[model samples]
Target: MWVNLGVILLQFLSGSIMYSYIIARILKVDLSKIRDGNPGASNLWRAVGWKYGILALFLDYLKGALPLAIFVSLGIVKDNFVISLAALSGVLGHAFSPILRFKGGKAVAVSFGAWSVLTKWEAPMLLGTIFTIFTIIKPKGTTVQEDAFRVILGYLFLLPYIIYKSFHGDFHLLIFYDGNFAVILYKHYKDLWGYLRGQS
Candidate 1:
C-alpha cells in the first residue's frame, strides 16, 4: 500500500512538470497570448516552428511515458490499482501541474503516454486511430472546441474496449479511465461549453 502511494505521488509530481510549457518559455513564447491560449505543442507549433513544436511534443510525451515505463517494467509497482494510479498520475500531472500554478495544459499528449505504457501501447493505438479518423473527417465547430468534443467522444469509445479486456472484474482500468476522462472533460470544459451553447 505504501509503495502504491509512493508511486502515485511520484507519478503525480512527474505529470505536473509541464515540460512543453517550460520549452515555450525558454523560447520566449508566451503560450497564453497565442491562439487558443494553450500551453502545449499545438500552440508551440504556431508560435515557433515544427522543429520546436515536435520537440516540445516529444518531451511532453516522454515525461509521462518514461517514468511509468520504468516503474511498471521494473516491477516496482505490481498492484493493479497502483499501476492504474501511477499511469493516471502522469496524465493528471500534466493536466494539473503545480509548477504551472495549477493551470496546466489539456493533457492530450500525456494521455497518450500514460496509456502507451500502461496497456503496452494498445490503448494509445486505439486512441490514436480515433484521433486519425477525426482528423480525416474534419469535424466542425471550431478547432479547439471540436477537438475537445472529439477527445471526450474518443474516450467514450475507448471505454468499451477497456471494459472488454478488464472482464476480470478488477476495477483498476476503470479507475484510470474515469479519472482521465474527468480531467480531459474538465480541462476542455470551456471549449465544450461554448460548443454546446453554439449548437443550442
Candidate 2:
C-alpha cells in the first residue's frame, strides 16, 4: 500500500513538471502571453518554431510514460489497480499541478503518455484513431473551442471500452478512465462551454 502511494506520488510529481513551459522559458518565450495563454506544446510551435515545440511535446509525453515504464519494467509496481492509480495520478498532476499553483496544462499529452503505457498502447491507439478521424472532419486552424470539444468527444467515445472492461470485472481500467475523463473535462470546461454557446 505504501509502495503504491510512493509510486503514485512520484508519477504525479513527474507529470507536474511542465516541460513545455520550461522549454519556452529557456527560449525566453512567455507562453502565458501568447496563443491563448496555454503554455503548452502547440503554443511553443507558434512562438519558438516546430523543433522546440516537438521537443517539448516529446518530453511532456515522455515524463508521463517513462517513469511508469521504469516502475513496471523493474517490478516495482505490479498490481493493476495500483498502476491505474499511478497512471491517473500522472494525468491529474498535469491537470492540477502543484508546481504551477495547482494550475497546469489541459493534460492531453500526459494523459496519452500515461494511458499508452498502462494499456500497453491500446488506449492511445484507440484515442489516436478516434482523434484523427475527428480532426479530419473538423480540421485544425479552426479554433481552440473546436479542439477542446473534439478532445472531450474523443474521450467520451472511449467510455464504452472502459465500461466494457468494468463489466468484464476489470475495474481498475474504469477507475483510471473515470479519473482521466474528469480531469480533462474540468480542465477544458471553459472552452467546451464556449464551443457550445457559440454553436447555440
- Superposed model 2: Cα runs more than 4 Å off: none
TM-score of each: 0.91, 0.94
* Highest lDDT model number: 2
lDDT of 1 by residue, 1-200 (tens): 77788888887887888776788788887999987898888889878888988988888888777676787889887888778878888888888788888788999988888887778778888888888898888855337777777788789889998897779675678888888888899998888887777742
List lDDT for all candidates, in order: 0.82, 0.85
**Candidate 2 lDDT by residue in tens digits, 29-70:** 899987678868878888988998899888888877868889
lDDT of 1 at 78: 80
Candidate 1 stretches with Cα past 4 Å from truth are 139-142
Error of 1 at 165 (Å): 1.7
